[model samples]
Target chain A: MPYVNIKVTKENGGLTKEEKLTLIKGVTNLLAETLNKNPASTVVVIDEIDMDNYGLGAEQISDRRKAGK
Target chain B: MPYVNIKVTKENGGLTKEEKLTLIKGVTNLLAETLNKNPASTVVVIDEIDMDNYGLGAEQISDRRKAGK
Candidate 1:
């Protein structure tokens, strides 16, 4: 029931509408504390991209280098 | 980049080893088509959960419901 679909990038230029509702309430509190679930049946979807359209295995990266790049 | 995290009800018996990978690929294709991005640049995440653990707007539901219900 917890639906979280987050595709990040956009060179950090996106996420403006209240930071996309605070990133779907911070990924619904990190998937309700890592899977315990119950943050009102968390359903978070944040898809934003631009940085070369995003990649990893083939090279390109974002989300700040997939949290590291 | 495209990183999709899908959390569905475990009630579906949860996807198996190959199913998870297939899902990621499916979502990647969807995002690529919808957003006009390269498939290689897409990163998808699928998180499965119990039905009772997810809710939408104070009402519990599943992907089936979210899609229409």
Candidate 2:
């Protein structure tokens, strides 16, 4: 039941909303101190993508097209 | 850049080595399909945790204690 999902590239800003909830509570306290467990069952999910909606295969994309896609 | 990380109880046992790979690919594909992005750019990470090694608060531990924790 350990979950961590991070999808970045929404301009890759430093982060705001309280530093994205303090980076999901500092990555759930670093996975409960690297596997000691029980930081409220550890569940973190962060997804933010922009770069013209994201890409990579048809051409190196993402990174929000350098702010001009 | 979009990434997905799913961590489940290792004892869940609904997947094998190849199935794990398939799960990753499937998740990636789902993300690409849902977001209409390049499959290569979407990274998916799945971490498995054992119940004995993972806990929920101070009790009600993970789904791993049924074996005699």
Candidate 3:
């Protein structure tokens, strides 16, 4: 079984349910096509993190957003 | 920098905020101790999946739970 986790910052109120489903399906299919993995046993989890919890370049995402950079 | 994604089943109403915080801290510390990683740049994401979305041994977690297994 292949487990995949996709983490995206919670921007614009996060992703919609349909978008999440699309990501799960697309990732599973890609793994099967490229790595010869079994789609039935593949697991894809999407994590929507708050901007305050995510950091980049020694700065929190929330702060970056506030600065518009 | 190290990125860690933790996947856990959303059972019994999922984990409390304190528990999640503990996991983030513990994982970060473990990485720092074992791999000399920088905790300040480490990213840890926790995913709580629904039983219905998780599968094992060709059976969904929801089904296994219903069967009391």
Q: Which candidate is the best by lDDT?
A: 3
| True contacts reproduced, candidate 3 | 0.05
Compared to the true structure, candidate 2 yields what TM-score? Answer: 0.50
Model 1 interface RMSD, in angstroms? 8.3
Can you tell me which runs of candidate 1 are displaced by over 4 Å?
A11-44, A47-69, B57-69
CA lDDT, candidate 2, residue B59: 47
Clashing pairs in 1: A41-B55, A54-B1, A54-B41, A65-A69
Q: Positional deviation of B58 in candidate 3, in angstroms?
A: 1.0
Per-candidate local distance difference test: 0.63, 0.60, 0.81
- Could you give candidate 1's per-residue lDDT for residues B27-52 as a string of tens digits? 56555644455687566767666766
Q: Residues B1-69, candidate 3, lDDT per residue (tens digit)?
A: 998777888899887665666777788888889998998888877777899999998998989999999
Clashing pairs in 3: none
| Sliding window of 10 residues with minimal summed lDDT for model 3 chain A | A52-61
Candidate 3: which stretches are off by over 4 Å? Answer: A1-6, A15-47, A50-69
DockQ agreement of candidate 2 with the native complex: 0.30
- Give the winner by DockQ: 2
iRMSD per prediction, in order: 8.3, 9.1, 4.9
TM-score of chain A of 1: 0.32
Query: If both were scored by DockQ, which would come out higher, candidate 2 or candidate 3?
Result: 2
TM-score-better candidate, 2 vs 3:
3
